[model samples]
Target: MAPASLLDLVAALPPSDGWGPSVATETTLDGVPYAPYSKADKLGRMADWTEGKDRERGGRQQYGNRNYRDQQVYGANQQNNPFGIIAAEEEATFSVVDNTRTTTRGRGFGRGGGTVFRGRGQRGAQNQRGGARGTFQRVGAGRGGQQQGYDNRGGRGGRGGRRFGYRDDKPQRNRDASIQVRPDWALLEEIEFTRLTKLSLDTPDGEDIDSYGFLYYYDRSYDKQPGAKTSEKRLNVLERAAYNVTTSSDPIIQDLADKDEGTIFATDTILSMLMCSPRSVYSWDLVLTKQGDRIFIDRREGSSLDMVTVNENAADAPLETSEGNKDTINSPSGLMMEATHINHLFPIQVVQESESAKRDMPNEHPFYNPAEETDPAASKAYRYRRFDLSLADSEEALHLIVRTELDAVVKNTISGEDQFLTIKALNEFDNKAQGSGGALDWRTKLASQRGAVVATEMKNNSFKLARWTTQAILAKADMMKLGFVSRVNPRSPNDHTILGVLGYKPREFAAQMNLNLANGWGIVRTIVDMVLKMDDGKFVLIKDPNKNMLRLYSVPNDTFEDEGSVMEKVEEDGDDE
Candidate 1:
């Protein structure tokens, strides 16, 4: 049978009122028996998608949905007719297959799915990479990165895997776990500090000590005296941290404050816990003095400080030389010691109350817990700590130190140098207070009044940051020594080599350590605080290894027996019903 043309079918079929042209899907035009739909003009016509049609091509029942002006309705192809007309005559058809299969990925339907015929777009051709290539490109390959592997190893040779050109099936390198995340040092070998030597401290044979090379000097009196011990207080494991800013104190600070002569100071000795040998240590007496918003920190030795004492009367003063750097705290010798301005380092506003840790049971609560508001998201965990330079401020600030200020603390010549004048000044400044510029000395003026408490806190963090920065560096080195830095074929220690994996050089670490000498206290604070938290990890159970005492310990998940700490902790509840 032959297919009947739409014109022949229209003439032969009986008229149906109201509805438009109706043609039979399968009807014999002659003895050959052919279908009229094969050649029907209606193949290119449109129908509403919302209208449902019966499987036999009959219309579905729709109530009050007809448009008298235009017969548009819904869903003519609901009964599985893939080739149903879908758009008005004005709309072009869309082809799923484009002529260039590798290029344009034609989509949707031909009409308002609206693609041009022959699988083309109204605009232009696609790029060689299979995305639109002109003024109005709908898709572009640039949206996605190149379809090539990223070789981070900086090697010219192809890597392994079918994806990589090489046959080896392993990654170039495996990152060692963040072993610093644990107090792995204590668990391994005994970590020790290089004890400081006096003015006789040696510099490498060829290398001269930076005028500000770490003045590593030991003090028998200070070492024999542990200054002040961190008060034995109940510390909540995750709720509170035993940081120097809060718990630790240097003897210098304690002595100054204990005078009760309105003398206040801050120091960074807290870090000695991790750095000094056997956990007993103190630093080269660095003291912070804050006057109003202005802050100045200088290292003053024991003897010089001993000369300045609280006088009951002006006449009772032992050393009363008037007017000069010596007469004032600014002695040429004193100036030769480190001195520079410090800035506020801690951002106290970050403490969110709800996120603050709490104990299920507390033996003794802290005397001061400053209350603060919390957001819904912040209450979940200790997520507020971000130790990046993102928050650091740049000013007199974070910038380079002044050259004159440098001359003061750096002493253009060191003790061993051939300069006789330099050695004389250093010796004279060592054991005695030169003089007082009477009441007019800047030191006397600055120390006369109490300063904002923040000054004290910032001063405290300097030690905290210094202590931890050094510790973090050592932890990396220790991790390398313990075979964590490199992997080997044989699981033996001899097969591996200790390799440093830190992103920074030792010099950079040293620079950061000295950053507290001038500015960058807050930045150093944030970074060191973050590293210390990581070094200690989330568990408590901290200890002074040399003393063999525990401050806090983590509650083991596998056991009910609680850890015994040196300090009192929240005991487990005792209701055995």
Candidate 2:
């Protein structure tokens, strides 16, 4: 074999199968078909940097960079090559460790784990991260690397790392309901605020069916510049024969119901609460009774529904002691009682109860009686109005009868005629308290920065203001007087002083607060339709304490009866006092 010549060895190789691949009997190698190649074809650059720029300049191909195209030999196999060199097994086991010192800007445990740089203004915000322009995040540890708690590399590879939801650093709120939900009650429907806000209905201005009671002239002195020393008046407790008769119990409403005047009946207070339910943060409930086709909105005796809530819609609403509210006076229930007392006392004090100056309504006081009542009647007039809530597409008419109220009357300066007024009071608790909701010092700011003070109140007590406006609009009052009343002592709620009064057109105030009356009417109609579909039984519409939702429950008729009419008992006790 060693003596054989080089030509003999080459000739012994069984005649070369041509220069390249064999041309006969084979079109493919294994399963891959052989591709035609030309000898003149030139291999592109190994590291082409100019191809991308050239293509970008519109001089070459459009789809991708030509420089990065495949450059490997078509049929080359390095393992089987005759000139391939094999390294020692010991040398193959040797590894190179990167010991170079690299400084990581920032390290976080989330998807965007690298250093988070922010502008000067965003430095103090803990949750405000920069955009994902140059963020480098590592999601998990590399193979043989120690596992880390967080990695920035796990980001989805986009400018500004992606975040799923909003970052809310505030503590979660868990509030209690005004009325306890009985286990026996059945939940019928749960509606979200997002859906309720989308509803819209346009109803008439309403027709005055009947008017009762009388109204005294509103004292113009209280309307002086708010927070003025001269305008400050002590809030007087008025023992007036005030009545909050529910729809089914009210004789006027029952008569109207018997006559089929409306399919729904509610007082202005109850109706406003239902209309403004979506804006509420605190829990509240109203009882509804469906008898045949008619539904009545009622409030239980001593119900929280009759009370006004303070800072009910604030971001940091007043919490109960159990919910971590340290200040007892600023607690929701405490604030409600204080607000109710102020509202009750502020209205009567602002009116001049002179028989000579008083204006009489079409009918006498509906619930007040001189023979049966010991206390004098309050200067309030009840107007039973009917609004047509029937949809244009509906076959049947849907009417709502609301029993509205008027507190006082004012002489129109221009027309020299009497204008009806709806009186409400906004009280200030401790502004420095946790749940103050960034309220300004009403005593110091009400006169000079009245708009700022009112704006703060609107933000904090959106639900309360909206309800008052709704009531005023429902009553068709020419003016809605919001009296600023402050406690005589910030620590004590027993006595209060009226700072001043501001008058606003109901519609104008509604616009300022973004209160949509049509939307409110629509919500009412929707709830009414829902209740009408159910059996003729007592139902309750309750606002969820923590979430923006409302739940309708079918309850037994005797649910609240065990309470034994505490409102009347309390009123009787007050009368005795």
Candidate 3:
């Protein structure tokens, strides 16, 4: 082949024009600013659930659902919301002691009392919580950002202040572990939210109480290296097009909940769910065509369509060919891998890219290399999902967790016939005509109830979605119990795997089993079909049809093939080990 001529390239060039007519942001909304706050989250604040009903009395104030925990709060997620308040069996009372007699009996009675010295200079001194009475020591009258009388021994959590950095709000609850009462919410600075635009309450500049609820939300951004410049090509798992997915209960979440005391444990999964766009286009290449020098490239964009056409015709009309005269040939996806060039001009490049990469469950076990493996402390057996109190629509966030801790709490807290068969029964336990040994413990009730408001709402669709979430988690958990887990990424000697900007290190979240996109019906679909024998498929996942739930097991027909029976009792506790 001879080298292409410069004149040939010049003749193949297509026409170019400036951008089309402009449009302005004023296409819809008024120029005036709306109160940034949307009253959506507060819609259900007064709902019966908020009142710690059947449980101890606690504060209730609902906020916008989609907002960060600083704004997104509901009865279920809020630690301070009456439900989580574990009341002490004995209430404390304070009484002042008479000290005049003691003073009189002292030398003051016999000798004349001396006049007190000037004290205006030291007037700032005061007891922190209560007066130091009798022989007992009291909280000092002064301690910056410290709780007063509440006998809290735990370290100040989070930011250690009120919603507006106010440590001044009266401490609501606290006690040493011996007493077992939870610490004050006002002290858990981590849970507090400052105004989006303001740093301190001392300044009355930016947003107010209402506007604060509408602060920053998760935008599904890419995770670049600490100092690396932001590139459009980099994307986290949730932002990609090949079916991005993640279970809501990240380890980062559990750390926050562990520290939370009456403060809201946020449930931002729904909004994160919305972040995974199904029709999302990850990337595309620019097709540069050349015939002789008459190159033609279609610059027009149709957002919904996948391909762009490029023709090399120099004339306005298509070339008169025997087969047909057409100026169309759509660009194919993944063509970047294809090698077709005119004089080595590499202009057909990937132009658009997703901010995140899609992730799937691993097909095998031991998530990390020999040196890097499960954290040993992270919850691997049963995933914990914190479902939001408010509801929203989501197609990608089809993830679910078994609420292992909640199940344990329910089984231990409520025994025998009192056990709930349905979520409604558990939720309605508060309204029972006969109060069962006081209120049925609101914290227990909220946690016990599978408040999958959105996921469970579509009972039919959730079955399959739940199966994938369950089976994969179960498999990983079982592997973990056996001192191994799925390989999260390809293993190397140092346990390093290229994890984008975060680098080739251990993953922060639970290790997963990938279900690739190539699996005809999708990974989750394939898992469900095989597990449930759906569509008359082979039954690998046993169905415990006691309830409508399609619980999984290896043997479909065995009466004792439930996950608890087969997976745990037989496999985990086999006694061979």
Candidate 4:
């Protein structure tokens, strides 16, 4: 007979729901029924039977039986029964079983429903205790007689206790912390100017005068430090003669007071002055002292100080010596008059026009028209005759410095350069406690004390403005030069011109540009202005509102040339065919 193929044998097997016997079968030899002595003996006989069946069925039977045995053993162990325990371990090795007697129903009985112990080549129905029920009761004992039971207490020899609320420990402080400071000097300057306006009044007579004019000097000092306090004080002296001549009860004066109740000039306009300089010092001398504590009061000197005349004899002498001996010298007429007067004044004023005349002219008036004109001859004569005292050399000039400093601090604070305290310091003379000057200095001293605090504020404002400006530039970069153009449909003459110049149909442009109502109007205005320019400039902008896709348009001229190339040749050939 030929051996069966694996496929044929598989085909011969019963269906999943059928209970067919295996291909290989077992029968007792000599017509005697075979029996197993112990539980181990039964398992050994089962393994042998499986091996023999596999040999006859071409290994199929053995594989199936082995799988079935594995599943049965696993299921029995899960039940935690004594038979399951024996099948798991000792049954696979030695044919061991337990045969013992116990009292049951008030009678001594030998093991009945237990395992049968079988020797080699022996067969019997001898019953014995099976698996763990056998007489071997020391199975789970350890070296120290420790027993494996439910209530067993021992050291941590098994699984460790579950970990509870454990976490990593770390420090909480940062070593590299620092603060940033940015100064917004420009904004500060604007704020300072605005504050000055609020503190003064406009005159009905068209004098654009403010309390600041009455101030001949202002001085302030600031200290630059972290977290410092800011302090400011101003000293302003009125032109005494002007104040005395003007009536205190005048309507203009009363009106000004009412308008600017708390300002520097609210109480007395004659002596009122708003400190507007950003820095502390204003100097009379530009060369000797770059920065000083004084600003000179009174009118500015012009070109009259540029030249000096002396007798030929005294020309060679020093200025001081020449002036001293001029009174004793004889003149051309035999009269001892001074040879010359030294022009000690500085030329501070270039041209002086009446303030009222400047006010009358429109800001955009043409250059050809006269805003104001002076007689050249008369102007030259006045320049030659005008004389001024040497304020730079006077002791009173130094007092202007303190007043200037106070005004500058106030001005800087109002403008937004809160950080002025970080870069400025009090004047040296302010240290001395002397009269009203000392009091003024004391007021300004607070600025230096609070410099650091103001500086921090300024720095923050600067950063904010910078960020805002950057965003604005980026947002406007592409359309900025396009001027005021809109994406609206042609409802007006301006709309038609804009659409014609852009070379896009109104609906198409509107959809592609994604322009809002306001933005559409702006775009239209921009294009109109660009068209008005004489340049043959082209406007190219992105058409894809979602992305940066570009569309370009050129200004139309009467003389524009158009030419065709390879695509035209293709069209011509197609037409002929």
| Backbone-clash count (model 3) | 40
lDDT of 3 by residue, 269-301 (tens): 221111111211122111112222121111112
Each model's lDDT comes to: 0.24, 0.80, 0.21, 0.21
Q: What are the RMSDs of all candidates, in order?
A: 28.4, 13.2, 38.9, 38.7
lDDT of 3: 0.21
Q: Model 2 over residues 1-577: C-alpha lDDT tens digits?
A: 4698655555556545568853343233356444555453445545644444333333322122232234333333333443334888896565545455543333344443334332211111223333433222333323333222222322222235443233435568777777888899999999999999999998879999999989999988887889888989888888987888877789999899999999999999999998988888888888999999999999877678888888877877777899877789889889999998888878888988898889999899989889999999889999999999999998999999999999999999999999999999999888888788999998889999999999999999999999999999999999999998888888887888889999999999999999999999999999999998998999988888888999999999888885667778988999999
Residue 137 error for model 1, in Å? Answer: 14
Runs of candidate 3 with Cα error greater than 4 angstroms are 1-146, 149-471, 474-477, 480-577
The deviation in Å at residue 275 for candidate 2 is 0.8
Residue 307 deviation, candidate 3, in Å?
23
What stretches of model 1 exceed 4 Å from their correct place? 1-77, 80-253, 259-497, 500-577
Can you write out model 4's per-residue Cα lDDT over 180-223, one digit (the tens) per residue?
A: 11132111001222222233221111112322221111112212
Provide the clash count, candidate 4.
53
* lDDT tens digits by residue: candidate 1, 248-339: 12332333234432211222222223222122211122222333322223332221221111211112122322322234333323322211
The TM-scores, one per candidate, come to: 0.20, 0.71, 0.13, 0.12
- The residue pairs found clashing in candidate 2 are 106-115, 113-152, 132-160, 137-152, 137-153, 138-151, 138-152, 138-153, 139-154
- Least lDDT summed over 10 consecutive residues: which range in candidate 2? 117-126
